[model samples]
Target: MVTLIIATIPACELALSDVFASLPDIEIEAERIVKGEENAAMPLLWVRGVEPDDFEAACEADPTIDDLELLADFDEELLYRMQWFDRIGLLFQMLTNANATILEAVGESETWHLRLLYPSREHLSKTKTFCSEHGLSFSIDAIRNMDRDPSGRYGLTSIQYNALITAVDAGYFDVPREVTLDELAAEMNLSHQALSECLRRGTHVLIEDTVLIGAAEFNL
Candidate 1:
């Protein structure tokens, strides 16, 4: 599920055959695809390209690529068959690996938008085609800003606090069913290690402030 973006001219009719021809070793298998706005000159592309390098050189040659660019060198294969829980875990990784400017929305199936500073039509076409073949949809919308303030009162780190707030905002924490730490971590876009630390610190504070204070308040 590694994503590599390449910017090309023209909004439609991407000559993918030429792009695939460049990387013959890595099979250009189709997967979930998506594209940018229909009217835009160049759209964003996300594809499961071949191993090692996908289109870094093309990005370099094309100055239209944005600073929060998707590098085509990393590996993201396990994402294909991951279960719902595993998918959540990977989602956290995706958020972490993504640039700080990553934009997220919860209105419909958790949409993420990375503002495209540089546009590429060829890459967008191929990636959209690939996603279509794999039954994934793509959209082009403005990136939304997170509502949580970073300098909050909690001891939780900025990301941890943001994650908790995001979950609370999304109503994930309000679910009645049992919530796994892994799942929470995944939902928060944090590693298990970080998630565990936050919980530990939170539990300690609760015991000191709430649990202890409650005994005195209620005479329990």
Candidate 2:
């Protein structure tokens, strides 16, 4: 069966990393490819991040960036449409060459984290080899089989797995709720809101995988 893999690619090997290095104070929260392949010109990207004015200036001055336009503005982050001149072709090659599907990608301070689905382990091996051959730094952070998990059903992401296990161990789901949300959040070293969101999403996945799916199978 196909496996789900979460990988991290160092900023040093990515074109966006150069942009981020130039604007060290700015952080990118999310990114989406708006149009065209990664290698093509005028590839539109929708980006959300802090310091809109600085971001604009940095992109304009950066050699890697071809052009940029402001799409929207908000209190926390601004949205941008950007075009890249070069240095992104390798990423497209990595995905297409491996025949992998990207589930999600997020950029942080030093790296671009990606969740991908590969046909099999052999395909993943080939992709890693391709990266090494091309001087791209690729590291697999986590992997799980979609067909089976320790819970005996749908696989949970590393974060979701940890959140659910921690909640149970800390007695967050106890009859009287042995642990407060704040206490649980502190124990996990996460903000209360973040912890709550993780648990909510984890519980939803667990229920869907174990209870809902099982019930449906039994009926059929």
Candidate 3:
């Protein structure tokens, strides 16, 4: 189970729900197996290209924009290599191949951050060195060092699940806005106490299915 989180925490959190929902919902028959347990291995590696100006233009352009294909292709290659190790988790990289053909088109000059998830530290380390040797000048941000909250159980009862969906729809629990529990309950037309238990359960499912297993299946 591995996932990569780039961007700020709040932005990452918002992106999580959106990203997970985009994945097909069909269930797989595999059981959850904790890999690299007790080894304190980091599962993610972030790589960012130095061409800041070009990276921003790529982000703003449509995904189908022809000019951005090269940068997108490079990112796909990184993802491909990571998956080859069976240790690859998630990847987010910044590059210089987008619609900003002119320098003036680059606004605010945003930096790109990519988070790559690997199955083990060994795999991550090897990939890191590979990038550095290639003159990529990328940095590594290990997952083990990040503060991942021990998520409480979420996704239990159907009512609770609905409440979570309601919150998500309203963007209530969004960390950026800090949706209050009371407010979420009201929005769901349920009592706050009842909603709280449901939220706890729903969160657990989200963490397990989306955060852990989602990254494990990439570019496959």
The lDDT of each candidate is: 0.35, 0.65, 0.34
Off by over 4 Å in 2: 34-38, 41-49, 148-154, 157-220
- 132: Cα error in model 3, Å: 47
Superposed model 3: Cα runs more than 4 Å off: 1-157, 175-179, 214-220
| Tens-digit lDDT track of model 3 for 1-220 | 2223222112111112221122222111111112232321112212133233443343333221121222223341211011111111222211111111110000011222233344444545554555455444333322332223332122134464567677788777677866777887776677888888777756765664345432221210
Instruction: Give the per-residue lDDT digits (tens) of candidate 2, residues 1-220.
Output: 6766767777666557666777665555445543355454343343555577767766776665665787777767777666655666556664666677765566667677766678777778878887878888887766666654443234555666787898899898999999999998898899999989988876776664444421111100
- For each candidate, what TM-score against the reference? 0.22, 0.62, 0.27
Error of 2 at 72 (Å): 1.2
Identify the leading candidate in terms of TM-score.
2
Quote the lDDT for 72 in model 1.
43
Between prediction 2 and prediction 3, the one with superior lDDT is 2
Residue-level lDDT tens digits of model 1 in 101-136? 122111111123222211234433454554456454
Question: What is the TM-score (0 to 1) of candidate 2?
Answer: 0.62
* Model 1: CA > 4 A from native: 1-151, 170-172, 178-180, 206-220
Residue 173, model 3: lDDT of: 60
Candidate 1 positional error at 122, Å = 61
lDDT at position 82, candidate 1: 9
- Residue 46 miss distance in model 3 (angstroms): 13
